[model samples]
Target: MKNKVTAALIASAMLGCLGTGVYAGSNLQEIKAYLNPGIKFKVDGQPVQLTNSSGAVITPIVYDNNTYLPVRSISNLLGVTVNFDGKSNTVELGEQTEGVSIAKGFDSSYHTKDPKVTIYNGKDYKDVFFDNGSGTRGSSFMLYPEGKYQKLYIQIAAIGEDLKEFTIQDSDTDTVLKKQDVRVEDGLVTIEADISGVKALYVHGDAKSGGSVFIPLTTSYYK
Candidate 1:
């Protein structure tokens, strides 16, 4: 007696859980759902725990003989990122254009050397990197694409009340691929670079008044 559930319904439920007022539609219907706490999940024959982003445990929901799982939890189990764009009312799975996070393939050697490089999450952004200011110039970091990605899409902005300049350069040739100056008031500036055939990238930021630079993780993707 498995029954198909609409994405709208799932989204509605998620929003309700989040205490958001957004509704999927006016034709919403209510159904009795039972929480099955005894159920377990496994991936590739290995057991896995189900939890939301808050680390709260989640269980399968049984409704009309059909089982439903939290989309975010299931996506996380499969090594996928789930994002909801409230403005567009859409759910995005994985990176846009079949891309992955530059953070995923970050060079580990620089981790100890560059303490200013940090992964950050905020109310407006998720899984992003913040280049905390260093000296008169802003912070910088390196990422290894390994020639697997053809394009890189990112949003950059000044973190605090200051203006900042950003540059993306080819690590091998030191060739500047893209440069932009962003202000905190201007918001996140989108940058698209043709990273075709490039192996490594050096991202640099220079601030006017010693402020940090922001690069979103969920929105930035390499394809």
Candidate 2:
């Protein structure tokens, strides 16, 4: 009887260890450490992660009093496929189970030689610095609709003597939406557009000149 009780206790302890990490009590945190910022988490049908500015995998984020991991690394570890569609401006992470459903990554911010707020969806996995492996100064984002917002917003650092102007247009259309001269002082300038029913959006701003941004719209997204 004594030997059986001891074996049962040992088994119970091992089972508890299986659900937790060495340093952390929560297994989710360990899983999240591998995910990219802005990739939503759904384990056993519950939301669990959020993205902060592009931080190194070593750097941890604390939100709602809980720490989270990056979505990029974690999902891949879970045997999920992650992909980006530049032509469609989409980033997607496949579902864990079979049949391959994109659970997140739509409108998720991506890096390019030139980046823009590129229609963020799942999570706003945006980085603070606009540098995308290149020294070129540009930015991009992909935004998902949380409420009643269809319009997109852009903000450029206002700086001294920097020629600032932006060209907004639809990539699918020959028509140019608007091109305006911008005066950026103190290293900041902000631009807003009322994109009601735009199918595709293209922007080129001369933080002096030369860049590309593509934004797509869904019918139910903007009202």
lDDT of each: 0.63, 0.36
- Candidate 1 wrong stretches, greater than 4 Å: 1-96, 107-124, 161-164
Runs of candidate 2 exceeding 4 Å displacement: 1-149, 158-161, 207-223
* Candidate No. with top TM-score: 1
lDDT (C-alpha) at residue 131 in model 2: 19
Question: How many backbone clashes does every candidate have?
Answer: 0, 32
Q: Candidate 1's residue-wise lDDT over 107-150, tens digit each? A: 43222223234333334453456655455665577877655455
- RMSD per model, one decimal: 14.9, 20.7
lDDT of 2 by residue, 1-223 (tens): 1233233333333221111122332333433223224435553456544222243232334544454443333332232333334445433443212221111234434332222442233423243223122233443333332211224455444333343455656566535656665554433444555442345655555443332322222211222
Quick one: how many clashes does candidate 1 have?
0
Question: How big is the positional error of residue 65 in model 2, measured in Å on the Cα after superposition?
Answer: 57
lDDT for model 2: 0.36
